[model samples]
Target: VAEWYALVAAPGAMEAREPLRDLRGALRAMLARVRGGRRDRVGLGRAEPTLRWLRSLSAFTEGEPGEGREPFELPRFWDALDQTFKVTSQEATKLSLAFSRPPLTSAEDCRKLSEDVQNAILAVATVYYWLPKGQGTTLRKMVRDATTEVVKGMIQLTETILSAPLESLSQEQLISTGGVWEACEQVSNLPRDNQAAVASALAACLGVVKDALEEMEHALVEGQDPYSDIVEDEELGFRGNRDTYWSEADRKLLSSCMGLMKASKACLKKVLAVVKAYGKADSPEQIAQLDDLADIANEISPSVDELALSMYPPMNQLAVRLNAAKLASVLKKVLEITKTSHVCPPSEEGWVQFLTGAVDHNMNKIKNFTQGQL
Candidate 1:
């Protein structure tokens, strides 16, 4: 049995070896108890058969017993394993009951319970691994159902931690990021198809939330705006202006641009909620809502971009007239709009370059006009 385990653990094993490792460890522990004379003769007799079956199973190992023997068939091997160690509906039901209970109090107790839960999940997954293509036997269905329930339980626990306020979360919970996603990844390795979809949803949900948290930290803690330096340069140019003359149309245009940016920010806030809910969306209706939300987000970006671009020509004309104060006011408004919009730029430097380019062009035009006048 140990040799069989060694072969399974060795490099280039054709199949997943996790369950085999667990099974081997359990068998070794059982053997130790038997050697200690803790189990009765009947227990030893039952274990002997299983041990002999495992020994026979070891023959499927790569280059085992002889050099030119027939290659091991993976399906046949899994089928034999399933027949030897059946996972009955009763076992799955008992596990389901245990998993449904509230979490334990102590850390040690929780760790032990977690191990048992993992073992139960692995047992169900083993049975799932051997199921014939498109075949839905009662026992196989029971195992799959149990696996789903257990996975859902794991997701709920992980989300409970993730959804909580960060300051209120325990150190352990904070450190255990991606727990649900990792569990889903393990389940995705099973032969079942829906496991992949579940894994994808969990991953997307976690990714969106993590990104939002990072963005929030950047905005709040860092007190840094990626567009700050560019806006400051434009502000300096505006401050250097000698004229204070203003027009009603200029005021209206500035007001309209600021209003459009504020509206875009509101739309972005709504899109964020949709993004957060997308992972938890189960039904077709909820999925359709996410699609609609995505469409709204896509629509808002271009509209806001158009509004930002519209201010450029007018601000440029003002700059040419040496109306530095109005130009400065428009640039300041642009900075305020960009900061409030929370729209990430296409690149690391963001839209600052685009905004500053317009200002630079106006400055060059003013410089040329003065030179021509002289």
Candidate 2:
């Protein structure tokens, strides 16, 4: 009967409470029979005490009869027991399903599944810790180990996703995709002792990517004057060589560059406005605005670099010297814009270096052209 009761109360059993009550009743009857037996019998004498203990607990299964137990109270106890079983079954099912799934295919999928897995882990841990000491030890260990593995996998997958190139993702994707920030938030929901290492690692990863993105955005939107050395070279060359002259072509190029600079500055202002709007909002509309900001920033980035290159003394010495202070001022504003934008790199460092180098090469070309003219 005890074996039967254990099987009927197993986690997957249906109608657990009904069979459990029946088992208790059968035990109660058997105990009564054993108690009525001859106490002098050799085998029955020692077991009688154990039988009495089971009978005492049977009162819980079948409330004290004729003792004025409130009618409402019985139903409440049954309802609470049923609810506990239902919740336990649901959580168990979720944990089983989460661990049974195949490997994740994409970052988005990974992000979603990681949340599910983490939730399941928390559920299992909650129940395990509530169990009395020495009870469910094996199951608790299994749950703890599973939680550790799932958390580790989640952290790794998040890093890989965040490490993807930002330029390749649309603004909508960037806003929706899970990465360091999302990972940190999810990890923070876990038990405190489990959170520290993962949270710290994720925070560090976010910091590095954020700094890199700021640097890249600064370069793209405002342009870095890589040809400062070229400016010094020109100043020395023209010091006593010849009067600096501006030809019609030179004047037209300078004007075009300045016009481009003015337009870029205007675009940056609009982009900043969009970014401000994005930051202030937490709705879907604001997310869509972020896409717009990204698009505008991308479109204006090249133009900004071209304008800066044109002003580099190596490329157009007269243009650089003519608007030296303004050029410096524009570059400074670009850095400020990038600093405030809060967008970070989607991937690694190679692309950032390439973009910066490409702008430098253009300035070098201008330097080569000026040398040829001389």
Query: Which segments of candidate 2 are over 4 A away from where they belong?
Result: 1-252, 274-290, 316-374
lDDT, residue 174, model 2 = 35
Write one digit per residue (lDDT tens) for candidate 1, span 1-374: 95775464443321222222333333333333222323233233235543543343234322312124444343564454343223222232332333233331233433344345344434433334444322222223333443454444343443343333222344444333234334333432443222222333324433543454344334333432334334335647532222232233443434433443443343344334323433233344433433333333334444444434434422443333343324433443433333333222333123444444544554454444334433
Model 2: lDDT to the true structure: 0.36
RMSD of 2: 26.0
lDDT for predicted candidate 1 compared with the true structure: 0.37
Model 1 poorest 10 in a row by lDDT: 12-21
Q: How many residue pairs clash in each candidate?
A: 0, 2
Q: What's the TM-score of every candidate structure?
A: 0.22, 0.22
Per-residue alpha-carbon lDDT of model 2 for 262-336, expressed as tens digits? 434443443344334334223334333333334334434444444455543334564553343343344344434
Model 2 TM-score? Answer: 0.22
Candidate with maximal lDDT: 1
